[model samples]
Target: MRTRGSLFRILGLCLLAGALVAGTLLPVVALAGVVTNEASETVESLSAELADEPPPLVTTITDRNGDPVATLYDQYRIPTAAEEISDAMKWALISVEDRRFYEHHGVDWKGTVRAALNNTSGGDTQGASTLTQQYVKNYLINVIYRNDKAGQQRAQETSITRKLAEARIAIQLETTMSKDEILVGYLNVVEFSRQVYGVGAAARSYFGTTPDKLTVAQGALLAGMANNPSIYDPWSHPERALERRDFVIDKMVENRKLSEEDAERVKDEPLGVLPDGPDKPAANCVGAGPENGFFCQYVEDYLLEHGMKKDDLYTGGYTIRTTMDPVANHAAKESAEQQVDKTEENVANTLSLVKPGKDRHEVVALAANRDYGPDAAAGQTEFALPSAISNVTGTGSSYKVFTAAAAMERGVAGIHDTVQSPSRHVSDVFVGGGEQCPTVARGTRAYCVTNASEGGSGSMTLQTALQTSPNTAFVILEEQAGMRAVLDMANRLGMRKTMASNAATGGAPDPDAESAEARQSQLEFFGPSENSPGKGSFTLGVSPTSGLELANVAATILSGGVWCPPTPIGEITDRDGKPRPLQEEQCEQAVPEGLANTLAVGMSKDDLPGGTAHAAAQGVGWNRPMIGKTGTTQHNGSAAFVGGTPQLAGAAMVFRPDRPYGGLVDGGPGNVRATDGDSGNMFGGKTPARTWFGAVSKILEGQEVLPLPAADPRYERVN
Candidate 1:
């Protein structure tokens, strides 16, 4: 074991070496002869390893109007410039931590010698780390070795070697960085408490104010915590923290940073910290609250999918401006909850809205009746109910609009072309109606379809067929347009995700499946297939779909055929305010303008008399010229409504979301059932239509009224 005299000799040699590197002259010149070449080389090597990279900072997300929505961070740090910090804070820190901070190069040799003698004499343990040395130590622990526990421990270990290395790095840093720069860097990197870093964040946390506005007492309390945060935490040990704060104030008085009268006056003041604790902003999308959380989630997903790394999002200090419209989102959320109670188990009502334009389709709102959170017992979930196709069921007859548009595009039929709408019809080419319909001679199971009402039993114009949403009429119309054409039209008109995978399986078919039957089953369920004409029910919307995509489909038609991705990001900038590039808008002409115009006109009568959604439209006193379609799946498993004016488009869906999902039956407010639908009580005209109208009316209240595009005579040809 080393003797006490030998330990003191070693400590003296380390202090002398640090003094020599820091350009300080000490009286102990004889001890310099004891420093070895290996010790000198170690200091040089460790100093060279110091990098000037920035520390992790909070990333802020804002709405279109630049209002803050949420903040994300690995460490709750907000880097502030030297001039932005108040003089009280700098004085408080300097007075308490190091009185000779400006006079010393990096190490205070006199203080080190004093501390060394006091420590060896068994007096109060004292630290002689200068402010610059403290900065070097914290930079190594919080930034360079942030992910390495052992490396952090080594940097913080109570050893002479670690102290020498820190001293050497601090000396080198003073040469390259200005005195104020070094001071600000130290202030920004040091931890004030758990997960809280930087004087900027500390000022806001402890005093509920900005760094430039901190008072003398508040600055003293925060600076005092830098020595031992856990012991001086105002939230946990108020009395001890007050004592520390008073000590700092006395130090300020002694150092001439403040008058004795001012010091005493400030010390007598109460610790004005937030009553609860640090005023940390909520972290991540969940902190965006229930109303805007769904839209926030979609923005996050869009950024990640476009190329942003998860780490970059949390620590890059980026300012992401999203296209969330507060008014529209609030209306949608309130309307959805009015239609369906948020706590109602497994029953969800979701809505999405998109602004229509040829150059950009900005998604402004995504709302669901269920609260966006992580508590299942409280009926809250983080699932992307309005945007994810896998979270929804079939959209029912809302898809007939796609088939009608396909017919108009292919020249197979026109808006005014007469089509046979029988009570029942059997599809000979497509397969699988199991036992309900017999197979034809083509050696394929027949697909049988029937109208939802007895009134759909005569030849009617294609426009009338859409208004009534006759299942058999659209199924026959799909055969005329060719199933492939209808499926392609749906894909081009914003059903990309739905057409890209099998919704029943929630993803693409598994290529490594053990049996061919399993693969075939996955391929044929609710999506396009390779070896077959697309499902005959494609026109009837008997496939799981996303509300955002469905709303975009309306937006596509409103834009006169140009299809643009529903983008949520408005702009992005780096920490220094330089604009950053995002994924370019991908807009394409999916169909001829004339064809889209005529189709929009064909769908215009849906909210008028004799249409499926007429009652819901009348209830809202809606008089704007618009296009709309209503759909309800077989057995009432789900109901949907898609509607739009020239300015905006929206879609709403009501469905059962539990496993082995079943039908939703309407029986007045609380009497609704999710498991049984044999009575066929629910329809798209009820909750789904009401939700769409209620939200859209509020969103479009002040906007200029625009009529639907005029129909092209060519597409209105008589059959």
Candidate 2:
């Protein structure tokens, strides 16, 4: 109805309104473009940093039962393949995190717009970042945390600038990595709880199961926990965890990913988390239980000394199974602790058991009255050996067994060979150019040795002399047998060139002694170290040896001269679960089978009726065909018993009262009596022999008893 000029004015005003709206929107559109471009640049930089290189995996060690003994790791991650991730878990994450994930690129435009509108409209501040953006952000946080403080700060800061940058990077990342790759990256790096950084760890730490094994309820529960792990810890807040879990289930049901009936059913189910979750396994011998700690530590040391890469222990995912018989080990421990006198600080007694046959593998059962550690449970000054291989005691009369074998090998004597032993001998020890025996000062250049029983028995067979452990006969026997033959025989039976564990028997000089430097300055020949024991008294049990080494020697005789070097490792597997080649067994025939059998007969239970180790023949209850010998070094400072059956072989030793560190693991110094509770002297023929009997009896408890060869044919053929 108005005039034409009025109509023009109204049209102009409507046009102006349109112009104002366009002007208002232009800056916002342009601003979005600029922000997206900047975000893309930041994402590009971050993508280059995230190589998706997973952290080191944990190396688990298990026992014979596949029970976990130890777990070695810097980060406790048990990585699994993506295929193991449950579909239910994936859906739970998608429903909670990115509803429009499949349709959108990495940035999820629909989600971002909705979130922005809700935030501006006085609603909940929704972080509509897609899974891809979340993954990119987490990776950036990881990279920045390790190497760049500024990058970390920017990643953590809550600002529009940061959000835009993450979106651009997320979009670019979508073009590079597939959806699954981004999802896996997210699963591996997402922090589920304190000291626990991945969904794999979360499943194990919370549900005590693997990702593939997760049920719908458990999957949803774990995914729900990822929201606010600190405030809603399943372990710390069971009520909160239940509430969040139900919420996730509701979301899945609302999305029709899960049926309403199934959702309701799972909602009422308990969290079903293991009470303590995953048990953190101990990593080393220090925590491998008090009973097995020393043995574990010994295996660790033995591997390093025998050429295992030390660093591989921590980084390599190796599954190493050892040759330790827990039954035998426990038996030996019980015997050593019970038979030996605990009252004496220096009265150290230990028993070792070895089973080495072509059929049955060699296993070391090294057990002592006191644990292998510093300080004794009852005393301050005790014999504490740092390693199972450390030779803390002398070989003692056990060395004579080797001498007898040497004599038979050279055909100088037979089991029935006859000799008349004199109370005293004044003859030069025929060493040729080798070292001479250290003895008391006498008028003659030759060493004069007397018998413990003055006026040596008139006439006795070689077996009789051995059974009596008569020094004069053995010395005379050694003179006829030749020292070189004995030395070679000992070496073949697992004796190292350097037989000294310390300076007591002329080994590497005692550094604690003023004369240590001079001793270390001594010349070396067969041994790498000058600490080698003196040669003169080699047959008199002067050489130092460990119980494990002695066990090898006895096992040689038991295996009919086939000497197998003691080994702890049964098998080793690499990080990739491939079997790694271990050192081959170094077995050799040190003596003829006939000679070994003959010696076994001479030291057999029947033979012991007239032998020094006769008491060993009378075992507590076991009647297995056993052969053994008793040993006592000078002044009875150390005693030993080496014995074995066709199935088991080993040695037991006891140190003198004055022998420091020989009886005490770690204790204040004290003196042990020469005898035990019943006034029984700590003789190798007594306590050590008793310990051996008890130990081997337990080892052979239910095994079949075997018989020795009636007579070694080689002995009959001897002239």
Residue 409 lDDT (model 1): 81
- Models 1 onward score TM values of 0.86, 0.65
10 residues in a row with least lDDT, candidate 2: 661-670
Q: For model 1, how does the per-residue alpha-carbon lDDT over 399-484 read when each residue is reduced to its tens digit?
A: 99988988888787898989888898998667667678887646667889888862377789999988888888888888888877
Question: What's the true lDDT of residue 34 in model 2?
Answer: 56
lDDT of each: 0.80, 0.62
